[model samples]
Target chain A: MTEKPMNAVSNEAVDSCGCGCGREDLPWSGRGTDLPITGCRFSLYPMTDDFVSIILGALDKTDTSHVWCQSDALSTVYRGKREYVVDAVAALFANAWREGVHMALEGQISRGCPGDVSGDSVLSCEGEAPNASIVAAATQPALAKLSLYPLGVENYIDDIAKVWYRAEELGLNPTSIHYATRVEGSIRDIFAYFNDVCALMERTVSHYVLHFTINVNSPTDEEE
Target chain B: MTEKPMNAVSNEAVDSCGCGCGREDLPWSGRGTDLPITGCRFSLYPMTDDFVSIILGALDKTDTSHVWCQSDALSTVYRGKREYVVDAVAALFANAWREGVHMALEGQISRGCPGDVSGDSVLSCEGEAPNASIVAAATQPALAKLSLYPLGVENYIDDIAKVWYRAEELGLNPTSIHYATRVEGSIRDIFAYFNDVCALMERTVSHYVLHFTINVNSPTDEEE
Candidate 1:
């Protein structure tokens, strides 16, 4: 696979420097999904002795044909259009879940990063999401911590505060902490909340990221 | 607690809007530890049926007197000076570790965020780190995925590339992915590598973040 220059928001050619230097003329607010590259790096941890099997089995069951995926010892990365990346990841988690085992997954999803244009080949694979059936099969309550970074925005805190407000309005129980907002609900609602926030931000911000850690099937604890 | 203005790198007071509005006079590279505020939000997950006991017991054993801590259902947050924040978190994780059970801790340690000035009260606490002994007592090899965000930098990829290069030089077996760089080593080494990278970035970027997930005592997986 050869590195190719993808069009910036202004349809300008970006430099191989991977810094959007040539695209400086385009206003940061002008960015959108017009740049089709999106990326997610995630690691799943199943708290059972059979973790290796659960992890590998989930990978085998999930269809990642639509995205470019690379798995290393520490984590797995999926890069492509936003929908395909999220679909593959959601299905991976659903397939990994076992009723009695506690599990957690940590990941970061980022879009419109200037450096991410190198792997644009995967965006060509276009069709409906392949893993919808698997994601529909799993429905579990999860506790999540989400931190949003609206990079390149001058008033980033405002963007975060707005998102937090919406999360509260949606009854996600968003409690503000130092670096993140805690939300508790079904996996579907949690994921939808994130998608909503990202959709809202896509109208303006160029480079944005959401970092989330989700835990499921925890042993009941009175202290928490 | 009432909110108060803190001095920015230029010694200018930040606006109450929490978006570095009044401090545009300062160059981003001019920022350093002179700001005297840091923040960390972390969660510990133990993969056992008796997780409640292990988690609560760890919190009870660890001391958070030197930093500001807030615990919610999803996670715990600590904010103060950089050393104190790290000390509290590292000690918390060390205290939480139990032999023969798989456990994971995820956290974000960030410095120089402009909106972080609201909690400066905790910075006045003085003295050496309170939990150094606890951190020294625990030494477990861990596998970690670390993602650094040098916010507000024009050439952010360059900053990340530099950190990845150093991780390789330190024999951390760094692997680059779409959104993060993975490193495998002891917990102490992983934390140290992050500290080293943050120190290097302190010279230039005013706002930066390091997000990490560490897993220990995993049931050996042959696939990995």
Candidate 2:
């Protein structure tokens, strides 16, 4: 049999182990389940006089059926499949967007955590993402700074550079910041870029993250 | 003179070039001034119905004499000396802290950006950090996730691991998350750790960043 990299095993390939001894179920293997456990923790800031209402109303409108959500004082965390997690964030942001009030959201989204198995139970839940309909909805201009980390990977900088190059290819014109890449585009294109980066890295890196700081309806843009 | 790695030049060493040809003042060098050119962009969230007053009060209390401040729709950006940038964040958080209120702050702090030279005008402004007195004040329990990026470095992950290991030595008990390291400790200790990590990486990397998401007085902790 050809050798594969330690973290390159596809979800289907990891479903069963050789000899069918149920060794994959053992704790020592560190392979909790076949599902791609994904989750995100995010905080939203709505720049309005009625900030509390805007934030609360958006969270209330978000549909978290396929995901498990925990709302702490610091931030809200959604854990489940990748599509659902991303959908929940989009729904929350879209719901919170006001015409005159600018909004910003900071979030860290990750999949395949070696120590986090909490999402394994709900990984098999079936259905399209709840907010898939909103993908085509008209979105305001969005500016974001995204930094991805391929944990435990030796050539991590190369992976980052690849993502940067890919973003540029999509006409995003990524600007290199201190530790992040800044991109300005429509919300639809931005989210698509986020998904594309994840797809590129998941093939080789078991655990990866997309830490995003997004701003919509900025007053500075209007002034310029 | 021996060969030196790029970005390793000390602040004092970069003051003048050999033979004093006045080449350093030109725009081609991409070096605007002698200052280190530090800055931070941050958003604060207080989990309370009176969040507006609390946030406004904190900003009013913070002494920004040594830094330039810009409040945008999404977040506030502070530019100046490294110590003042850090101190502004600490001062803002401390001033905003209210009893029975859980507060969270998200910020990106960076020094030595090649493209940014706005802080050059105030580069020589000198004073001890304005928030130095608050450093020793009793602070609430703070939980934070910090990710440092050393841009353009080949062995970036190795540098990240070094910071992670050093955090362990300080008894911060860092938990490896997707793109960040989570640490729970006193606010003072946590900020100190942030400084230590920056110092460790700044020696070799020119444009390094500390993206911090900090939460204080969480209700979830009391539940436990």
Candidate 3:
């Protein structure tokens, strides 16, 4: 079989951090002043009933601390430190599954570089953001996209739109039916997020015979 | 928002049924001689680790009655009556999730047409295949594609290759890194499968955090 490079296609839009942190100018060692970050862009599709409330309910239940979570009619995007975002996703899927909700999710997880950092005002964190020391010791940031589909839901457009409205109210321009976000941080953090997200999706959706996929890219400084 | 037709793109390969059943010649009403079928084509990606035996172990635990299931290194494929196939996937994912294995999956669920019926020996069923009357009352067949990514597992290529060998032994091409399949039957059967599969996946994989996606298509005779 042909071993194709996973990240051959670069379709996602990468915008500079709006905070004007000059995140890119920071040293690769992350020692002087720049703090490394982990981020992701994701979307979830509920395949069962099309009631908009289910999607909205799940989004509402999620904890956004350490992650900037936003949704549009098509999907939701989460960006922030890798650990908290992963935890948030785990909590979201667990609650949905316990409530017998069926849905599918798609996401891109990454670290080592800054992703779309616009709208940091809505960002919530348990404590102060990471410092240069945290970045210096962390692994190179990486990126990956994942998907999960719980079977049985249909006519989800209305519900998706409702969530989109909420995101719009939060000042996010969630206009695309196809949701995309950028993430940057240590490779370990990204992998951790990837692993945790996959685990949760599998546990919840697999029992229902749902199908899912994940493509990961961990770029090193040499590769960059 | 623009309401785009879901199945606007036709990239998947479609082949005629080899059973000489003349399924297409049958009336759209599915009344006298033809039994409508619901079918799905799917692939699973174990995102956590690369242990092939674990994935095979999960597949080994599945019940194929009412569906034809196959796998290669890259992914697994299931086809058959919607109800049976759905049941089988639910069982498979549930067992895997309980075992704490993480993986992702991709699938296509479709009705109104038969797909890749060339190999029928591998077909497994609890009772006889559907009769003409059963097909007659069944709704038009529908199809969809889905995905699930169980988090934490990694290095799955070796394990995938091991599965590929099994598919090759069964006479499947089983070479490409990408996996795709097809299913056919009534919409009810397909929906049943979808709901059950999602439920099972959710129940099994939720604790670990997984990601997934599913796209469905149910076509009426009029649309054709």
Candidate 4:
């Protein structure tokens, strides 16, 4: 397998293990709210065009799901053919304070992960890492937890979209949107990725849960 | 009319003249984007049960939007006619921002030019002013160069709503959502208000022109 370098882009050796070889939630430190790392510093994964498109598609569809707390878009990953790696921003803060999540990062996406994509998820756009180096570390999960939210996890996509758009309108860049759909090539690739993830969720997770509200936020949408 | 009080309920009614009473455009202030002499400094309106109902009403019709931009609560106004508001912290913020009309103390409605309530064109709520005060302010071409959007001016409502929900989900108070909505509402309202004044536009604004765009970097909202 490639080692956080250009040669690692081949995907010839991805999914080796699950102990976060590349799924470093540690970078999520100081990102999510209310976490033990609330103020502690840590670099988060960079948001890419693929990151947002997948989230948007999953948000619209009825089957796929991921944790969604918007501190910032760190990175995105479609895993297990059904789940996606979603680390909501400042989740710890929101949960603890009963308020909105607030992480201090902008243009978080369109940035890229700290190292390389490391072949964690199936997004073909992985492999490109952000030029910035990591100085902080992810507070242990004991300090804060990031998990995919089940379907119907408090419908807030519309609200989130507004934040995304309004920020852009005000010249905030919000890179998440501009890069996702506006960037031409990435849009098509990401859309296809979400389609596959949603399909898998419908066929698998929905069946497993049976009547347990899989992708409950959006049932009719085929690509949410 | 109650004379401007030197010490007021949060500095909302300081300038007896610019009060959105007999005039428009924050009559108290002589400039655009300027809060009146005695304006709401609390950045919020006091919460009462009636105010709570408004919140429920707003949330009820949130789904009609195609994009999260500022549009009327057409769906919510009618659909949630009977819905009760959530008196929770966020709801308080939403109601204030929606009803406050950008200028907290200097509200257009309070000024007496009840622009256009013919349909579900705007968010009209109960104000503390007496009928006599507001009615007295109503006159020919009553109100200032305020803008109200087209009744169906909803190209951006969906987008605004998403940011709103995200703000809520992110744990920001409904004010963020309300402020966003009001900005949209004000943009639409100002457009409408101005249209009423000028009665014509040289060109069509847009199929997707946001009735309004708000400042996310508001001094307080940055509290994260």
Candidate 5:
């Protein structure tokens, strides 16, 4: 069957700003700054008698990416250009499925909308970085939440404590089955830290299930 | 904190095979054969400008599974002892998430009950396979359906024709956005074929989203 390009159709009709800002005046719009920005936060639950071993094996096989990726006991978070984040996750699952493993996943994806202050910056690619002109055209963000029950590995919550300790170390209080935290930085800095955290978790745990909630608030947004 | 074994608590109260079969008579009940058997089926939509290439790259990286896995243009279906299926999936997502990719998924999970004849035979391992006496303890089946909407990759139906051709080849009719097929065999054999179909699809497409509906019927059931 012939496949149609998802973005071939204009996104303008549906790109209204959540904050009621007009599209024309939104940041990241003029000149070459209108590129899309997307982010996703997700968690994985590995199911096995030796789930720790399996998680370690999977982490060992993971390759670093340009997007921001973070892992705690509850979940992993990734933030970057929409396509980059999606590509990173797709590669991850494809690798795991090939290995006869099972897992459950839950996550959220977000993109810049007319009034989205959080997704204002364009993702950088080596020599080509976002300039002042591009940064000024940022838009609002569009987001969606999702959950995957591949192989029906719903028992991911079994390793919650692994992340709970991490959360505590990060000065965030955690509940029995959940934890929360906030990171602050420019989009690039946030992703860099995210990548570091994921690497650390990969090195620390053998098997794990994590749930992560990511909010790409403006770097200037007040901390709660 | 100490981690508690998830199954240390009694599942007997809730373990009635959906079909109404007595758990005691089931094959996997005695001799520590009572491992959890969770299963899930899912589809993914790669949201990228080069989605086809991204999907192709992702599928290339997929490995075979002990769990039964099948894919057509619309969705992928996986079935097996719950843990194996879940573990296989966990590995897949772990790999995908690491790549910073995005996709959407939808699927179902089912297990035997008193009335589910198709789910009766216990999934076996090695020399201690289920015998006639165990098969006699079959039951009904219970199932649940779910969907994942990461980054709104819900337009997975874009490649309906790939499945349409396969459906035609199998002499089964298909709809605009869906397809149907019935497999008649011992649960083990049925899952075996399911795995084969998924492997074929993985090889054929780079990026694909499939929607699948699977019905495992007794060999005695009449074909449509």
Candidate 6:
């Protein structure tokens, strides 16, 4: 069967550099769909408990291919009010049998595998087991519904509220600025004002459609 | 007086690419300065009637500097959205004069000077006419406080609102998504949901500080 083309706009897991640099995927930094690894175009390190100390050092470099990993190795990416345990250390390679995009996810898998997940010994294995319910055994296609990391609505709404609250805690206000700002108006009142506007937009637009079209020209650096 | 070190961020117009890549003052595009223009970037086209056929089309590859500009040539660019003309285009060249950053600008000047502007025929003969408005004339040192383009609030706010409206239009609900999605709970909803979150972030963040920073290091794209 012929592989489908990736569209730049529609691609979620696919990576493409907008720089127009012509260099598709480089392993280091944000050049394309690369994790910030110091060496190598890409590396797939085996995650384990005391067996390794990789996650501690390059915590920021890990991507989302790791949902079955658990360790202090997980770096929390704060979306807004919600924080997800994003394991950068074990990114890309989701076990040898895995095919397709897998992020190094860091979360605790509950005892007793509920889904198709079967392993030598998940509890004792170095890598934290993900929700068997999410990944399903690698047999049929991996469940597309699972988050690279566990998340919910809180990641969106609650976290935004959290950041604002944090800003309030930081005491950075409209007048707190040092320069003559475009925000000459009241930013102290902006949070509430913006919240209202968002509410209105949400209410109005929620009735519309997102118009998702599949694009075949999108490129992912990791693919080639 | 001694000139400052070349390393310092200067106010003068410096076209790093050297071809009509727009001005240097507003040099950076994406990534809060994290992303600069990659290769030979393109400048936005000029928007006035005089610009449409007269100046822009007649521009030559060697015409980097406008020292020899005719009165009619300067009229269109110096015309409207006065501050944008100066702030985004003119000032970049001004600094470039001091620092020697050369580049080609895509657009052109024209005879379409606003009526309010002085259209002295004698001044035109001298190549020293008020083709553009001197309305936004100001000096350096007031750079941060300058109102050359005081539309920051409107731009950022509008951006956030626009994206939010787009997502809400998606009308995601419980039936569409797969996981614990607040609405449709489908896998695709995650991306839409995040974009919505980003829209909100862009909205709220615009109000905080013009010097805001964002470091988004996500773990994975999505393992499908």
lDDT of each: 0.64, 0.60, 0.33, 0.19, 0.30, 0.20
Count of backbone collisions within predicted model 4: 73
Candidate 6's residue-wise lDDT over B1-224, tens digit each? 12111112122322221110111222212211111111111121111212222223333211223222221111112222222222223333222221111111222211211111232111212232221222123121110000000111222334433333443466532110100012222222322343244334333332111110011111222223
Best by DockQ: 1
Provide the lDDT at A89 for model 4: 21
Model 3: how far residue B3 lies from native, Å = 44
Candidates 1 and 5, the one with greater DockQ? 1
The predicted structure with the larger TM-score, 3 or 6, is 3
For residues A26-116, write the lDDT of model 3, one tens digit per residue: 1212111122343444444333333234445655665555565543222344555555655565444433332222233444443322212
TM-score of each: 0.75, 0.64, 0.29, 0.20, 0.24, 0.18
Q: Where does candidate 3 stray beyond 4 Å?
A: A1-224, B1-35, B99-106, B113-224
Per-residue accuracy of model 2 over A1-224 as CA lDDT, tens digit each:
12111112111212211110112232322122334767777877664545567777887877878787765434666777777777778778888887756567898777654445443235666888877777547367788877565543433444555676777787776654433456777776777777777777677566555778787765442222
Report chain B TM per candidate.
0.77, 0.78, 0.40, 0.18, 0.34, 0.18
Per-residue alpha-carbon lDDT of candidate 6 for residues A1-224, written as tens digits (9 for 90 to 100): 11111111121221211111111122212111111111101122221221122323333333333222221111122111001111121121223212221212211111111111132111222344232222222222111100001011111233223323433443332111011100111211222222232333233221100100010111111111
DockQ winner between candidates 1 and 2: 1
| Candidate 3: residue A125 Cα off by (Å) | 25
TM-score for candidate 2? 0.64
Q: Please tell me which model should have the higher DockQ, number 4 or number 6.
A: 6
Candidate 3 vs candidate 4, DockQ winner: 3
Which 10-residue window in model 3 chain B sums to the lowest lDDT?
A: B215-224
Q: Indicate the worst ten consecutive residues by lDDT in candidate 1 chain A.
A: A1-10
Q: Considering chain A alone, what is the TM-score of candidate 6?
A: 0.16
lDDT score, residue A218, model 2? Answer: 54
Question: Native-vs-model 4 lDDT?
Answer: 0.19
DockQ of 1: 0.13
